[model samples]
Target: MINRAEGAYLGAVRAFQNPMLDLLHKRHAPLVVSVLSACFTAERPNVSVADAHTQIGDALDQLRAAGYDESLPIGTSRDLCRQWADAGWLMRQVVDDVEVYRLSAHAVDALDVAGRAGGARARVSQSRVRTMLDAVERLAQDADPDALVRMARLDAEIRRLQQELDRIQRTGAVEEVDDEQLLEEAENLLHLARELPADFARVAESIKSMQRDVVTALRQDERPTGEVLREYLERAQHVMEATSEGRAFAGALRLIGDPQRLDGLSNQLDVVLRHRFTGRLAPQQRTELREIGHRIEQGLDLVFTTQREASYVITAQVRNHDPLRDRQVDDLLRDVMTGLQTWMPESRRGQSVDPLRRLPVAEVDHLRQTAGDLRPAQPPAPLEDRDDAVVDVTSDEARAWGGPHYAELDRHLVTLADGRSIVDVAVAFNAAPEALRRPVDLLGLLELADNQGMEETDELAFVDAVRPDGTRRRLAFGGVTTRMKEAVDE
Candidate 1:
């Protein structure tokens, strides 16, 4: 007794409320989609929470630099990620005991939509029509309850194939699909493949939901254990069959599960990439075609891993179901909630409680005792006098290993600056003793020049300095000129 038009209008409203549609229709849809596409890919579908913050923070900086300030969401990367998780565009879960952020099914769907929108439009071609025809025919043949109709359809298909084979054998020539048709079919296949990630994500999400339901049911203890166990068994067996998306994924898995089929797909993709017609395709398109098989494999692996983890968690919970413990924990939580409710009004009026940064230390009554000795068993021997050891005070090699003689250099510079208003640092450096002519000494001279407010000139100058190992080398640096003290006073 409902009007079809009103029902359709209400349905559209509900559909728009879906996370995927919300993502697509949001004001910052472009920003959200672009950021997600850059962050998550087939190669890296999940990012640790910390890494997500850093990468997205850097991405926002780049966007702002590229003039997207007005379009960017407010708050830090952590805030934005939390918001996205709350909005159902991102899934925040623990993977390998580490918190990570993964693109939700809704987010993946939005990305697929964005990717297709940015790519070349799918044209209405013979390849598309043929694909539709083939799908419809196969579906009819499979769905036909009458055996005669099915047999007749198969007979016609067999005869047509036989005719083509006979003609090919007679002419020794095979019909080649043109470049246009091949490209069309390749694009169509890629278009279908693009949805695999979203589909796989949905399946994983559904399994997680089932896990939550099973755990809740187990904890509630409202039903008998036998009934709950039976329901769980049935759900576990049909986890992949529980939803339409999961069923489609199961079918895909069956098709791709064969190693031989995957290998054949890889070989075909390689051959296609080598074809001259593929040159017309964009680089992204070509790369996607090459990776289609691997992408499907990764998606399947993710889903399987998710299923196993969910099953393990649920099974463990079932085995460890403690109704009394669960009830006690629920009571404690409710008590806490009641206290919070009582305190919230007071808090709103500025009565606040200091939040603990960490758990307090526990108090203990007694401590363990330990005894140690700082004194040695026997007294250590006194230091020996080495004044009788030979010494080489005048060895140039000894001085070479020591630091620069700053006092000697200062006196020498004063002597050089005596009637000259300006002194060139390189000339003074070259005239100094070998000990003062070490590279360290050259650096010392530059520091002195710099401290005297002498700016380096653009002209290049070279200084010959000896290394600690007795090797001499020439080094080039900017010309530095320092004025004498007398000149500065004048």
Candidate 2:
């Protein structure tokens, strides 16, 4: 058998290894504790990532200004927060598309420890002793194996309460608890109330662990999907029974699940706060009593949110589970791990390798889902006999209907030029060949002029042109004149 000293030594080792004790043993424990307490409160237990970073940075600056610089961590708020998260002091999660930071169970425990140690009132008090005694008595009465013994205990309690009630009614005088005792009891209750957040966090963390385990089992494909799903379903349905913390919280939830129950608690707290004894209590303690119901509600909300998220994850995975794909992913991951192991022994120290940032896009081809005849169901109608339908067209008429002769127009413009001379677009159009003098040719001349850096005139110009079919038309547009270039500058 181990001696008491050895047992105590082993216990200390295990306790020190816990994240909560680790936080308290930190080099800058005071900074961590004070900053966390100032940042998080019962009213706002979690903060958005940006807001948390900003608040922490401000707090750090304040500390530095106070000449506690040497006691502070050596980094920006963001870096420090990330470090804390890695060390299990904070829980970083995404809520409603926003990343937020909440005190982890370990952090909450650490804060509780710091708060208890900061004051002399945390020492054993009369109310605390009485509370424990009453709890033990209740436990013993409830756990008695003999029905007669349980009934006798209940009878004794009822008689004692009845005797007090009769005396109060007979005398018409009610005895009140002393202010000092009331304050002590109130403080003891607050200590217990302060632990709710840590308890809620632990339950949420437990649910998450169960969810992760179920997902891993699903991906392994070692069991049938139905079997795995059934196991998860049972676990989800009886989540409270999955862990000791959850089971205890489940009982507390049942007691306070009713809205009226919480309202009653709040009313009682309000009555207590109004007493003269409350005036002696610190402002923080007064607020804690008043907001106790709200604090419990917030903790419950957090736990419910975690439960819903876990359920959603499991449902989505079950709906989309693919054994073949899971096996493929596992194979690929194994290959990657093997490659890394092979390369590690041969690699140089401090050497780095670039990561694959993206995978090749999947290429898919359109496929015809149905078959249909390429040819028409019926033969086409014979061409209409139109040999004598339109016999009035001539070559000149057809040429008039065609596009402008740009080549002929260019040749005419070059021939009319007198060595880099400025030619008015209207004049050039009038001098062009008859076949190229269609109204469309006027637009071509304008385009060519623009290409040669034409100069605009304030006065409008008109172009007179004859179509190949002897049709005359007049086009009016903005004046544009260009300097004709020699063939060498073409």
Candidate 3:
């Protein structure tokens, strides 16, 4: 409702409550609406009260044409009649059985205050006899008495709310309400949150605990080496994602109270899902860790890398293929048996660790006897004890000592490659026939390095292991560097 002037509003209410106004509405309201709508829409000069319904319809049509599409659900005639009557702003009459509508006195009273010329009420005087005329003629009232009654009820509601508006305007401070005070309820909620139940408090404690654990894990240098460090980093990354999820849950708690569904299972589940480091380890993972740790503890020197000047920063657990694993196990077993060879002579073969260092006394004596033992061959040659590690035999020696198979090896027709090129063939050689080509790749050269360890020996032998003829490429001793402090045997 538009804010009507104070006088107009009070007058409308007075008119509405007045019993006379009720009679007045019963008489003229519809006719007045029809005429007013007609005149407001009256683009033309002549309009009859008898033509009020048509005029009202024309006005509604004009409104439609003007793009004001307010829905007039029922016929304009009856709706206009009902609205004007309800407002007590018009009057109705039947002249010659033809319904005509015009304005009423009370409507004039209110509209005069609303700045209307004469609300809807008007009267005509003819010479001597004067008569009252009003705008109440446009009713087809017999059509639906119930509809009119309903509109009357709605009109009463309108009057009631209008009066309520008037009362508010008179003294209520509702319009200028303060926003800060409005947020008082939320502040009360915050106070309640401070006094949280035991459940939420427990959750907060657990979150703090988790924060401490992950933070501590990040702070510590628990990973002793690169591989171990990488594994630790992987675990950290996994748990960090878990922490992100936990944080999400924490945020979600702000929306939905403490999570009750998983609350009981939270602590243990968090350890498994959120903690990065496990205090305990499985037997096998523990064994691997210990072995790798020992390898580290042996000094970073044990890791021999291919790039001579490059540091062995990366320790790849050699790809665990079955053939490789089997070979490693067999080598280990062979080493064990070799170490106990003298006691367990059932071992057909006895391997040497550095033949130059661990010389056989008997072989030393024999070499002494051969040269009258003069100077006693102080660095006695490996007369009998030699490793199957470094086989260094030239063509003539290969023929004389290695026999017919020696020539076959030169062309690779015979694949007796392991340690073949490094060790003197007369002292040591591989007897395995590569009939199926399995030993092709891992055939390390038999390097005769002056160094005392197999790692250096292997590294040196590996660097300079080859027969110039390229027959056994496995003896990759094609390297050409001079004998340095730790020079590999060529």
Candidate 4:
């Protein structure tokens, strides 16, 4: 319908050649279109031609060709001429006793534009029809002789599409066009299968798979590679299950043991998988694809649960590194990430996770982004400010302690450089394997007043505790080791 409307408008917009003009001469369209066309061109006045021609212009000849005899039905050529004059498509005048009907500039301009665009639209429409017909020809060659009927059907479809294009051109718009080329392409391939000998049919079955695949590939927006495989396998199985007794590719798959062909298809699959998966799949998900346990057990035959008859023999041949296969792994990773979000406790984890430390970059970024604790606090500004103060020092503790937290008696355990126990150094250190027994010993303190060696400090400078929080707090580290000995001797 849209195409029809467009075609109608397109015809109205352009000027017609002799044949087309003949078609439109007495039609109702010329009255309106002639005026609109006039609005588009420069005017020419006082132009005269010889009376031996016995006519005004080519437009008059068109009406005459359309049987402008006095015997016509509703109105004869005279009556129609009067109508055109009234409608402003033409003007009547006399000079030297010769009548000349001149085209209005409006009519001329509309005709010129309409003619250009209309011709262009016609050309494009013809091209599309040709393309569709080419596909039909291929289908005819491959399908059963009886399937020739399908070619005719496709031709009809092309004709319909051509008409539609014409209509759209007229209207200057095309919307909701269901013109997926693959749909017909698949049918064309299928036709070849139907016409081929059994030996060829075997290969044809595999090719027909292309048709089915096109339907899926375009429809799925975010479909994972593995899921696609799974879909293909299931589809094959369903088709096989629906019809029985024939051992074919769609039915038996054993016919596809041709090594070269298998390699080619497998390579294609590899390309698809590489594009879709890559490192995109996470470790856990990757692990899942490697697991043969989840798949139905088969000896020697490897099945891509997705592709029908899409299986291979487990020889020394290399495994297919299809990005698509990795999609399963990728999806599983997303699921794990989302699941951990709700239940997992905060710790150090990341692309480089120290299971012992539990710090993840994503989690860290989340903390940085989130507003500090909004809950009521002892001081009222929200205790979340304090949350930033606490560090998961175990992350640094590993540099300090060398291994997972060990009990103090284990002998290697040591305290922080401060008096605080190693266990107390980290935010969750209390819950860590509690193994610390003592704080680190302290040495005497001195100030480097300038670039000189150093400046001696008063005994008071080396206090048992120095305030880290700005306010005075008696947080101690260790007793003076050598300073006390010197002082005692003094």
Local accuracy by lDDT, each model: 0.86, 0.85, 0.39, 0.40
Best-to-worst order by lDDT is 1, 2, 4, 3
lDDT of 4: 0.40
lDDT of 4 by residue, 58-146 (tens): 44456557876343334434555566567555545554466655543334434544544544222324335656798797876677566
Model 4 segments more than 4 A misplaced: 1-27, 30-73, 121-490
Q: Which candidate, 1 or 3, would have the higher lDDT against the true structure?
A: 1
Backbone clash tally for model 4?
38
What lDDT would candidate 1 get against the real structure? 0.86
- Per-model TM-score, in order, reads 0.68, 0.68, 0.17, 0.15
lDDT tens readout by residue for model 2, 382-489: 989887777555676666677767777777787777665788888778777677778888777777877777898878988788866697888888887887776337
What lDDT does model 3 reach?
A: 0.39
Off by over 4 Å in 2: 1-4, 237-244, 323-490
Clash count list over all predictions = 0, 0, 40, 38
lDDT of 1 by residue, 1-490 (tens): 7799999999999999999999999998888898899999888998999998999999999989999899888888998898899999999888889999999999999898887788777788787888899899888877779988888878998999999999999999988889988989888888878888888999888878878887898899999877877887788679778777788788879879788888888898899999988999989889889998888888888888888888788779878889999899999999999999998876764566888799879898988664487765777799888988866867976776777677888777878888777889999999887778888898888877776668677899999999888899999998988876667778
How many residue pairs clash in model 1? 0
Q: What TM-score, to 2 decimals, does candidate 4 have?
A: 0.15
Please tell me which model should have the higher lDDT, number 1 or number 4. Answer: 1
